[model samples]
Target: MIPQIRSRVLWIVMSGLVLLLASVHLMIGGLDQHEEKSQRLRFLPDGHFLRTASLGYRELTADVLWLQAIQVMGERKVSPEAGRWIYRLLDVVTTIDPKFTWAYEAGGIALCTLVVLPEESNRLLEKGMLHNPEEWKFPFLLSINYAFELGEDAKAAEAMALAAQLPGAPSNLGRLAANFFVSAKAPQQAIDLLSDLYEKTSDPGTKSLLGERLKRVAVERDLQLIEGSIARYRQSHGGLPSRLEDLTTSGILEKLPIEPYGGRYEYDPHSGTVRSSEISERMTLSMKRRRDSL
Candidate 1:
């Protein structure tokens, strides 16, 4: 009976030890995984430091760093801190190999869209533009970031204008740039862009389209000035103007604006609204585009 009790007690103690060891192993594994995930992209030094250490194998260094960057991107969750770290890694890669065009473009896009870090994204793209001036995609991408992400129409127009001037740029870039300028309330800039396009493009259809667009934007510009004067007149007189001429007669406008498209400005006294015979849908299109972007 004594031998039987001792055997049972030993079995129970051994089973408890085995279970305790398994639990400890699982706890250690969980702790290790958590620590590994918590580690962000701080494994690399900055760009300048890596450049000095590359030992003249700059391209090789860049390639290795790029692989690491992609690995982290695939594994980590999208976050601003992670985006910034990725930017740093790409910056190091570019520093080692300035001609790495895809790194600049891809890194910029990832930073902007995935992490919503515009400043870092633009910085990477600007570096690309600096290194590769002939690459129209950089400036085109800049236009997208500025127009849609940052909501800076003038900056977008400028970037898109540069893109349109480059070889192999899309044909619609010019029209889009003009629209951005007009959306920024710089109608003359739009008119100038369309005028430039008209002079350069040999296609008759495109030429005619540019001509019509230029005339329409000019009419819009004049309307903007006239309506502003009418609003001022209403504010001073406490009533709507009876005619378009009332604006100048009331000393609000220096002169009646001439319509650039051989069209006349029509004023509605009841609603105090102004329209042109050459009513361009540019403003409406621009408004819709802005709304869709939001």
Candidate 2:
């Protein structure tokens, strides 16, 4: 009983000493200093190391990190540094769980749309494609990146073709694949693609919007055909035609092309330019007005 009592007292004394030491340490350093140290230590680690540390809970860890990334973005209010960190966080998440399609999709989009980091977005999207080869979203996003960001029509077509091959992808993607073959310069291809999308979509607002796009594309197509015929007539006759009928009269064109907005094709002999009478002023100047809106 004596030995037991002595042992209990010693244990109590030792516990007190340990706590006393911890208190002294905290007092010496100060909470503010400790917090500053912690802040300094909050740097991101390598994603591969994180994945290795996650063991079998990689997906869960990735999800947590993704949430944290989102919170950081929200907190930072889209500062440039936040944009860079978001990519790093997304990379880590995707590295941990390659099969998480939403991470890749959302990450890629944010990187491109919000961050405007095309190269980083393309890298994330391509990585997603490797992991989810059967997913149409990755390739579709890649196609958008190539077409809009990089201005690579052939690459866009390649990606769109991959997307079209996947199940559940919109059927218009196949037609788009063909248009990409024309370097995305053919108005007919754009018109066909828009028509197909319009046909399959069920939303009224979207259909109405697509109707505008269809009309614009049609006008663009008619302008292209008219311009090509005029160019041919110029090449053959060494001058601009006096009127739209001159092309048909000279056998350069079988007949006058139909105007998209139900108006006659207008010819300006002074400037050797062709325009639709019913086209808006913006459309008459450039087709890029609508494209710029995109």
Most accurate candidate by TM-score:
2
Q: Write the per-residue lDDT of candidate 2 for residues 1-294, one digit (tens) a residue.
A: 999999998777666645533443344234333553223123445678767765666676676666655554444235445567667767878988889877776666666444446667789989999998898867876776666556678988899899999988877888777777675645565566557656865745335545654675577677777788999989999999998899899998898878756777778998878777875442323324435778
Off by over 4 Å in 2: 1-42, 73-77, 183-294
Model-by-model lDDT, in order?
Answer: 0.69, 0.68
Clashing residue pairs found in predicted model 1: none
Candidate 1: residue 24 lDDT (0-100)? 30
Query: How well does candidate 2 match the true structure in TM-score terms?
Result: 0.51
Count residue pairs with overlapping backbones in model 1: 0
Can you give the TM-score per candidate against the true fold? 0.50, 0.51
- Candidate 1 stretches with Cα past 4 Å from truth are 1-41, 184-294
